[model samples]
Target chain A: MRNSSLIPFRSGGGILMALIVAAMAFLACFALAGALGASKLAGAWTDGLSGAATVRIGAEEGAPEQQLDIVLDILKSTEGVIDAVPLTEDEVAALLEPWFGAAPELSDLPAPAIVAVTIDSANEPDTSIVQARLDGAATGAVYDDHGEWRGRAASAAHAVRSVALGALIVCALAIAAVVILSVRSGLSAQSANIATLRLAGAEDRYVAGLYQTRYFWLGLIGGIVGCILALGAMVSFDALSTVSRALPSLDLSGYWWFLLLGVVVFAVLVCVLAARITVLGTLRRGA
Target chain B: MILFENVGFRYGRGPDVLQGLSFDVPDGAFTFITGASGAGKSSLLRLLYLDDLPSAGKISLFGRDISTLTRDEIAWFRRRIGVVFQDFRLLDHLTAAENVALPLRVAGAREVEYRDNVAEMLQWVGLGGQMHIRPPQLSGGEKQRVAIARAVVASPDIILADEPTGSVDPEMAERIMQLFMEMNRLGKTVVFATHDADLVKRSKKPTIDLKSGTSSGGVAA
Candidate 1:
């Protein structure tokens, strides 16, 4: 519990400081949640892309069924290949529906046969060796591990994560700035109380502790409010997304809640530290 | 013991408010610092409380030179000397008991350890029944008593009262002076600054006349 009577700051700027902390904490929560969400999204994309490969056999290359059979046999014989399955004509048409629409021409266009191959993540087949085997037998077969597109997707996901993390850091700095300003204003407003304390033989650190404790409580309360609001927002958005089927749900893992808790703790620690430093600096400078 | 030798002080870039003041306040003695307004009575008390260092010369409190004390040492040294400001300076938000407990609180004593002592001190100052009242609700004399109680609560070896009775009626001023006198009898040195000559003369204590920058009335010259 705080010894609030020692400083009498409750009447002056307490509410303003708490509200400011709440607003900054609110911003910080969003930044942290965005960063955590982006990190999970990046992991999902990387995993999905890394665990699969595709084998495309042209229709003009010998008998298309023979070409497909040769490619499937080579992939099945390959080490680290978990499963290989050929896509049906209808499945291929469905894959093309996004760009070509429901046109009958997509099926009549002599599309190449595609074999989906799953690989053991611990050990993937060498694409070079697979391509060589296909080139010798299935003439126009193309072995694509999707490494290029996967790299691009991974890079994009990483950039999003980085941007979110940058935003989180910026939010932290902004919160610290607000804390410093509030502490300064508090110091000014409570000058008489401070002078009385100092004259009463209160050490600088002891006086600073009063401010630190005040801000610590403010930070904790405000951070909790902001975090709850952010969590409610995330849950509501997730629920709305489920109903509308537009954006994906937040889908935060269990450990991500611990990360959110860490954000609250971080805000509190930042406020305590900012108040301590500000008070000590101002007291020393005035001294 | 408080000792001053050829001491001088001034605000930044301004003329000296006090100059060449030399006096010794014997331990356990009650000394009055009497002067007109701006004659440096409060300024001298400020110096004694380590609020401002003298612009020139030396002041030794309890045998340690004030100019040579480290910041930490100065703080620790200040714990031995209590100050009562003219305005009372009681935190208006705190009750009379809380205001009286300020010195002990600042000295790091927990409430459990000092609660009884605070109550007793308030009772000693004749505010036993009004302990729960805030300073704003208290009369001027009651507030001054609270301020006095706060000053002496930490058991400081010396009490420096700067016009502590300046805001009260004569009867209340005498009561305040009696409290200081009681403190002095208990072995705490008291240095009181006031412009009220009648009060000073009535007390008949040693006087440091700041107006003429001289020591008289049994204080060491």
Candidate 2:
């Protein structure tokens, strides 16, 4: 009966089914984004003092060349600190390319001096103690403590992730609503069919089972289609960002499989629930 | 096997469709319910089938009180009875044999056990060669026979038919009525609703007449 009832969901050129799936995909992607972002931020926060950290050395603008020796000397002796090198103009230009495009606007600006710091894997040096040593002599030099900002950055990233997941949940709810409403409307149109079955001694479960079966299939087809579309969109995005690995990106992590599962489940559940209500209501009205 | 005592039913706040309608149908009896248009014959059949509960009286079928029965129980009760509507409510998609086999299937009979019986019933109704034809393809008389076949195939305890012969020719009407009579003789209570005076007089079944909301009549003219 469930299969027989679902024949109508496929009867049309599949309009209702397409919309339902698209909604599922939309929710899945949004929820997946949150998962991706949170995972990345967590990875970044935990390994804050690894191969990636900012190194700062205070120096007067006119005397950077003279102050370079002392800063380099301090960096060499610092415990658990790897090689510290001042950033060249080309490295900064490459970092700025994504924001300003490949043709960087270089005419009116002098490159701000940046230090590249690598800390040892086994331990990270305390930057504050080093900061005390170079304070008075190197006036403009400050130790690069990127970890100071990691907490705030991780907090902000986590916030974005929460919102993305919440949006996904709302999307799931909306998909459920859409499927439910369409199922109910379809049931109304098919009331005569339902009444005939009831008159033929079909039980409430038997009659309602028809609607449930129809909705479950509708949700599934729709979900699979929507997921495929989202996967396509993500693939295209991945292709466009080939050279830039540091910029914010979305990748399907281990947890995203759960989200995909959830999308399909949500679709089926809404359809079943909606169909049950519709069938029971019509039968109750003695139609 | 069916009885209605002081049964009064209304659509809503409207006047009664069937008011104080007291009637009894004995087991295996064939009876005709005759009245002019809008005289509540259909309403009376509706009550007999438990399609709708009467607003104010006790109705019984198979000796069980129906007025206080739950919806599920009423549904089960309906399975013990069969009906043929005037419009010939055969599913347009189902074949003639399939339509006839419906009630038995509804009663949860196994396919292997019912297939041969359904085929015999369809043949008995004079649709021997058109078992595979759908309702749309069948002629009016053929469709009515299909409906008749459907009503009796389950061998229900009672059969209620509303205007069973309204769409068929006189000869066909007589044949269909004979089918109902045969079922009655086999111990199934039967009620036929019609306004055809010729059918009423020809059949000679006890007539339950309704006129201006009363049973015992003053106008036999």
Candidate 3:
């Protein structure tokens, strides 16, 4: 009924415990964000590349317009191919501007004409069938489905998500460890008070509840502090135009806040459970 | 009521502090445990309060063998007994009333329910005016009274005290002894342990002299 802690915890160890939990929660926030961001990025990259392809016609593949027309005809006739559109010479130069930086002599060099093709993801046209048909009409035309690049991007994103999740687990464990140590220290420091309470006929649950409640609140408060800090960092990242562009997929949706709340709840649970187990164990041994 | 049969106790792997002892304290009895500094007086009291199990032999409290009691059952049994520690073991940060209410609090009584009882208990101990004073600010005798108030506030069936009046003057000691006597009058068994021979002789109560390794006077009413 009395909510005050019998064990005095206003010591350096308690502060240190809070700080450690805060640090862990802070890192956990970033790790959770990274995992979520990687998942979203993977979906975007895979979807962007999966259902589309390109057709490249080299200069030696006869007149550019004639080769482009042939590739378009083949794609349009193929089942599962949504639409085929050719790129003009100026559009090709614009695509290459990042690499060539506006070279005036670009027209003197031999460049391939390109055609973009969209396909139904659920029923993609067979690349082999389309490539064979194009090769029969124009020998230098090459069909590209972008499947290889998509797979690599998805793999990279998957690796990032896995690492982030692993990091989150490590942070949770670290928080648990810190709480355990802090509770053990509190027990040792207040061993006399504990003995007094025991002699006063206090149940083990009552004694353990004191520490558990204190540490639970400590963890919850620390988690909120860390989350607030993480939110500030995220908001700042969003405000920075260059960084946001580099990490464009980090657009935190509503689910991001929900997941962060989950982290705080998990942190409090870890603290309460750790304190309860430690105190009970120590009391049992003393008894 | 408590019964001890051939109780032998040792601290950890050390030699026995008390050896081959037996005594029975009937309900509502007031018994004094007497000995020299090392005659196992405090050690024997620790046994009665269930702080430590006997290294050998058996102790039964309220007709239950302590050795067979589970941890929870032990706690439940302990709640029926109260202890006034030798050092007055009040928390330095807590006020006199808070210290006295510990037993009630441990029993899960709400403050609103036990608050008046705590104030009344402190008053009974002559510490009503010092209820809000912390242990550090209270005198030795005041702390002793606070301890006694704490011990009996929960209305336990037994009160075990170890040198409760050792830190106070003779006048305070007598007054403290009166508090225990009052508790006994209320049908609670009181076991007092001390090296104060004068106080024991003055009270003329039954005593178990550990130096003799047996009961001296028979159990008292």
Candidate 4:
């Protein structure tokens, strides 16, 4: 009739359990955010590289200007090439400004003339055919489509996402372990009470239900607090981004709340299930 | 109704606490199990309540062998029997009213149905004024009363009490005995295990006296 008959409203061990659950939930939130952000970044990198290519004309015997025109003509004639525009000398200098400081001597350098080509999404250009056509018209020409860079970016993102996923899984197992240990301790602490209830005709399910209900509430409260703290951390980190570029700026604008809600629900379910299993397993063994 | 035939029990590799014991308690019989300390009174009671299985024997209750019942069934059987411990094993966090209503709650009775009944039962045990108080706040005699109230509140067919009045004063002991007697008169079988010889002589009930893991029957008039 009253929860007092089932379990104490507050216990030192129970408080410890709640704190453990909160810590697990907090870590889980970060893991989930990292996985989602990494996946998004990977998608952005892939999309940015998918439709573009670069054609470089080396400075040779003939004027580099004639060579750039020949490379552009080859690319534009290709079936899947959408557009081709040769980079102006000033534009090429701007690209090198990151490595070499801006100086009036930049024009004196024998930089290769480069043309940017946009490929049609519906029809991909056959690089082998374009390369063959360029070889005959313009010797020492090179085609770069950024495939290697895209591959490296995808691999890096995948590794990051994998680590985040692994962290989340470890957090889940840790939460379950905490619940099982806490419940076992609670049972030991309340053995006398449980014996009395058993003698009064309580079934194992009935007894286990009491602990399950208690854990459900404990997990819910802890999970919400953990989520709030995690959100605050994210906001603080975002704010720090204004002062320095070292901190990662998580784009919380998309579906982040949904992920948070999922984490809370998942935490609650883990607690309840863990408590129920521990209680039932102990009772069965005693039986 | 209970039957034990050639029941032998021991804890692990230790000596047998109950050796080849045979006994039967019929329905509606008020029986006392009298024995000195370490005479197997508690062990025998634990066997009767299905808390421990007899190492070697057959135990039957209500025409069904205990060994044949599943765990769930054993729980259901326990609902028809009530047990009161010598230490008044009331949950300390629960109020006297909640403690008394435990059996009913365990039976899955709704609060609306048993709330008033629990209050009335506590009142019958002279604990009406202390219903809201936890066991820690109750006197020894008051705690015993609450224990008794809890045992019989569900109107079980049989009540097993281990030294129900062991911790109370003489006057309170007699009062507790009267409550058990009242339940017996109302057609509930009552069994009590105690070393109290004077109370045994006064009650004049049939008793199974246990000595060194053996039992001898006696009747006092």
Best by lDDT: 4
Query: Which candidate has the highest DockQ of all?
Result: 4
Compared with the real two-chain complex, what DockQ does model 2 have?
0.23
Candidate 3: list runs displaced more than 4 Å: A1-4, A11-13, A54-117, A124-143, A242-256, B197-206, B212-221
Candidate 3 yields a Cα-based lDDT of 0.84
Error of 4 at A16 (Å): 4.1
lDDT of 4 by residue, B15-65 (tens): 988887778888898899998989998998887787988888888888888
Going through the candidates in order, what is chain B's TM-score?
0.95, 0.93, 0.95, 0.96
Better of 3 and 4 by lDDT: 4
Candidate 1: pairs in clash: none
Q: Superposing all C-alpha atoms, what RMSD in Å does each candidate have to the true structure?
A: 3.7, 7.2, 3.9, 3.7
- Lowest summed lDDT across 10 adjacent residues in model 4 chain A is found at A1-10
Ranking of candidates on DockQ, top first: 4, 3, 1, 2
Which portions of model 1 miss their true places by more than 4 Å?
Answer: A1-4, A10-13, A57-115, A125-141, A252-256, B68-72, B196-206, B214-221
Name the TM-score of candidate 4. 0.86
In model 4, how large is the Cα lDDT of residue A95? 92
Each model's TM-score? 0.85, 0.74, 0.85, 0.86
Model 3: residue B23 alpha-carbon error in angstroms: 2.6
CAPRI tier for the interface of model 3:
acceptable
Give the alpha carbon lDDT tens digit for every residue of A1-287 in model 4: 35354667456766787788788889999998888888888889889988998888876645988888778878878899999999898999999899898988988878888898899866878777788888889888888778788899899999999999899889889989998988898888788788788888899888888998889988998898888889999888878976788866787776889988888899999999999999999988983
